[model samples]
Target: MMGHAHALSGIVGWMAVVPLLDGHEFFGLRFDLGPGEIVAGSLVCAGAALIPDLDAKSSTITQTYGVVTRGLSAAFNWIFGGHRNGTHSLLFALLMGGLTQALALWSELAVQIFVFLLLGIAFNGLGLGNDKNRLASEVINAMGTAAVTLALYASGVNYAWIGVAVAFGCLLHFAGDMATELGVPLLWPASKYRFGRNIGFTTDGKVERNIVTPGLTIAILLLSFYLFPWPELLPQA
Candidate 1:
């Protein structure tokens, strides 16, 4: 389900408001990240959003996350006993967060970049970003990622080094999911990991459910830009 909507969720991660809940700020100050920033942030965001799907048996994202998904599925069935049980826990989340933050620190990235990259990928796992995307639509997602990444660059973020760091954030996410069968590679090295072969769930009600949230999310993401009265909130950056 990769498409314009997936791009938007990744873009939203650029807002960098999560850590603010704990009263911390990135870049030594708190300022609104304009759509440009959001666009740049979406690069890693898009990768992370879909990171959890790596467990699917034939998924391309899974294959791209690390090693080819074909051989790894066997190892997964043996470990953790199942997919949803092991890989999606808070333990892995912390590992991912720490790894991304470490990369950012190693690369001297701003805290904002580290957090948003994690946000973008996680949101996709919640079943929101790519209801419209498929294997062939990767560049569509990449463009979405680049839009946010470049926006940060244009805003004087010096993303030249941070870009590699962001990719590592994506790598951490993909690798974490590799511990499960539903993993994805996120389009790197043409390979990825997985933890399961199937959840035994049917597609019977998926269409109806997907039409609700994914569709609504798309509407909001778009209206926030093209339709919503944005200037009233903060001045359209």
Candidate 2:
């Protein structure tokens, strides 16, 4: 799937899980999410949906951070043995989730500094400023994103939920790739089996653009309507 497709899938994936997390149990565990948690979780899930593609420099996730992500992408390709290898595995998802959780637990200053650095890289990658004012623009964008993140954190959003959202996003990415010709290695290092094996349309194909993307979008809208407390807004007759 392409970048837009992956993003849409991320949102749909989050919505698909919302009902399960709200009033149902999965693997013998249930999640009782509040409204704030649901919003935070969905946003994080959508953002993290691009993480798996970080191994490809031209990918949206890498392009967001431009040259900053180039090195990281190269390193991931090297260690994971190219795209759809280790990074697409369940193990990688778990590691990413753990790392996100740890970072979310850091002190306010630490979190701010981390977000600033990440946003700086992202802004620079996106060509926000020319050589003359690049540094200034990077600082401004980084600070802005960091401030927003901090405000959300202070507004009763749970950090653990953010980590889980990211993990689930990656899972959805892997699932989406499973439909492609080059499937994902869900269990890498230990098992060399690639799942999904030519199950869907090619990446960025007409079918994907016209069919799958629209289908997922409709699904998301319907799920949102069903899961959200719409009855509260109904008029008393």
Candidate 3:
């Protein structure tokens, strides 16, 4: 699937679960997902949704941070057995979730830096800037990412569930890929089988561009209405 499709699925997926997760406790973690958390999780998930594609040098994720991401891309490609291999598996999700959770537990500064990086990836995946103009787009994306990260920081958004969000986002990416012709290898090393292969529409093709992307966009809008307190947030005329 395309980058935007994966990113959009992440946003929609997180928003879809906000209601069920809010004010609930699961596995000893409290999910008090207020407005700030909802927004932060959405973006974090969106960023993570693009992670599996990091093995591909030309992927949106690899291009997001230039040298830093390019180096990571090279490393992931080697460590994970190339694109769509180990990184697309459940194991990868678990590992990433564990590491992110550990980081969150270890140091506040580290987690903040991680969030900033993820938000940058999210903005890039969401197609926030002009593709034709590279320089302008990077500037816009950087400024937007910084502004949003700072805003969420100022809002005191607790990231206790960031690990779950990251793992779930990867699953969402797998789901999106499964909907494409070349499915992801969810089982990975254990079984080199591609689930949903040859059964779905082509990636970035007509169905995806016209139906899937638009559908996701609409879903985001609808979910936003259902999840947020619009009446309270908006000013009365």
User: Model 1's lDDT to the true fold?
Assistant: 0.42
**Model 1 spans with C-alpha error above 4 angstroms:** 1-32, 65-82, 108-151, 158-210, 226-237
Find the 10 residues in a row with the least total lDDT in model 2: 121-130
How far in Å is the alpha carbon of 41 misplaced in model 1?
Answer: 3.7
Per-residue alpha-carbon lDDT of candidate 2 for residues 52-104, written as tens digits (9 for 90 to 100): 88888688667665577788889888988887789999999998877876787
Candidate 1, residue 2: Cα displacement in angstroms equals 9.4
lDDT of each: 0.42, 0.70, 0.93
- Quality of model 3 by C-alpha lDDT: 0.93
Higher-lDDT candidate of 2 and 3: 3
User: lDDT rank, highest first?
Assistant: 3, 2, 1
TM-score of each: 0.47, 0.76, 0.97
Q: Candidate 1 at residue 87, lDDT?
A: 36
Candidate order, TM-score descending:
3, 2, 1
Q: Which of the two, 1 or 2, has more lDDT? A: 2
